[model samples]
Target: MKLRVFNIIKNTKVEGPGNRYCIWVQGCSRHCRGCQAVHTWSHKGGELYDVEVILDDIFNQKDKIEGVTFLGGEPFEQAEALGIIAQKVKEKGLSVLCFTGGKLEELRENQINKKLLDNTDLLIDGKFIEKLTDYSRPWCGSSNQRYHFLTDRYNEEIFTKYKNKVEVNISKNGQIFMNGMGNFDEILRKVDLMGIK
Candidate 1:
């Protein structure tokens, strides 16, 4: 159940809604021009850990985090493993968000990717288009990419429930951040409880 992961950010604000634990899986052949995780492009560059161990850590931080974010070296490449992890996170009552180089439609067609997205709350998808680069967007590196609300089909009611509540941010300096569905005070409280730096 273990997967190769380039890195793990126990507490991050810009990755997903609220303070989230971001898992950066290793391996991506898509090498977009401005790829931030250049080091993760190689499939053989990461360390492996059991899914249970990663899940345990995330669940244990529930009281201190609003959700979990999956980043990549193309998470969909290990969609099966991602699905396993997502299911466990869902059981913990925390939402899941993912970053990918694949289009939502393309991923939806893949059984494994769909399984992972079944429990995903949001997806920031599309490869980095250097020509369409825009730093103003939330959770996306380039303007060509989009933020897709996959939870419950991006409907009105669902939108209202999550609207303004969940926000992921990326600083100009490449610092990732997330503001959970709850307010800033709640996020700060969770951060304090987690003893996160």
Candidate 2:
């Protein structure tokens, strides 16, 4: 299976409970207004990477990471490919966290989506609602989004700790990227004013 990858962050503390390798899969069907990642909304964009190769990359740095996180375009949109990768990651004893625009019940109705959910330890679900923008929940873009803990690996307290916190990274080439749950428009505007990107 090959996944259409929009971006990858090798290490990040704000993605989950600990340092994590984050994969932002390409393409999103739901183009919610005020979405920060408008660049990732196209289904035809991004490069195709084999699932095994991605797994190898994660395994190579397994010791430095507590788990892997799948963000989007919509991780569930590429359910089959991600499910395979998630399964392999779990085999290596790393936790899996997936963020999806689809609701849990909607995803559960599909066999492939169900497999992806089954492989995930935690799921942050629902479309990002601009009107419901929330700054108090970790790993969730909106108040309407819910965190579903499929396994006992993480607790509510862990989620609360990282809420409203943003992690900003500047690449070697000086491109800027931001992650975490909150209204980041103002902060990003400041970054733009500083001419960082």
Candidate 3:
């Protein structure tokens, strides 16, 4: 199968745990306002590439990367192609992560999307809300999104246990700042009082 993708980053530290290979697939419809990757929202925006070819490149980096991340253009839209890549990544014993605007409930209704979900180890889901931007949320652009650890392991749980929010800020001057959930003093206080840590 062939998939349209905007770009491929061989190594990324922010998208997921450790270092990850991030694939930005092409096409999206839920054009959220203030989307960071606005260039990726159009359906006809990216280059076409064969799934096997992309897999070959990923395999080349298997030695150094911890896992692979599937970002949009709504990865669920390319479910068929992603399922193929996810299968190979599983064979390598590498963790799999996905970012999507579609809710997990809706994804479960489609067989193809379900396959993509089955192969994913971690999922960050829901549309990005600009008004909800908090520099202290983990792996999500907005506070309304969620991170699910689909697999048996507790990696994401541990991550959230330490800090549930992941904050990121980028300035026009090209400066970047990222902090974990604990940095939000009010949230930390709630977590402590509620014994939710």
**Per-candidate total of colliding backbone pairs:** 7, 0, 5
Cα lDDT of candidate 3 equals 0.78
lDDT of 2 by residue, 112-184 (tens): 7867888899898888888888767777778898889999988787754665678888889887788866567
Please identify which of the two predictions, 1 or 2, would achieve the higher TM-score against the true structure. 2
Runs of candidate 1 exceeding 4 Å displacement: 152-197
Q: Model 2 misses residue 135 by how many Å?
A: 1.0
Model 1 C-alpha lDDT per residue in residues 1-197, reported as the tens digit of each score: 88899888788776655688989999998999867567889988999989989998888788888888988889999889889999889887888888889899988887777779888888888998777765554555567877777775333343333323444455688564553322444665776687651
Candidate 3 has which clashing residue pairs, if any? Answer: 135-167, 137-165, 137-166, 138-165, 138-166
Identify the runs in model 3 with alpha carbons over 4 angstroms from their true place. 154-197
Looking at model 2, report the run of 10 residues with the lowest lDDT sum.
156-165
Candidate 3 lDDT tens digits, 48-107: 999899889999999899899999778998998899899889888888989999899889
Ordering by TM-score: 2, 3, 1
Provide TM-scores for the models.
0.77, 0.93, 0.79
The deviation in Å at residue 64 for candidate 1 is 0.4
- Using TM-score, give the best candidate's number: 2
lDDT assessment of candidate 2: 0.87
TM-score of 1: 0.77
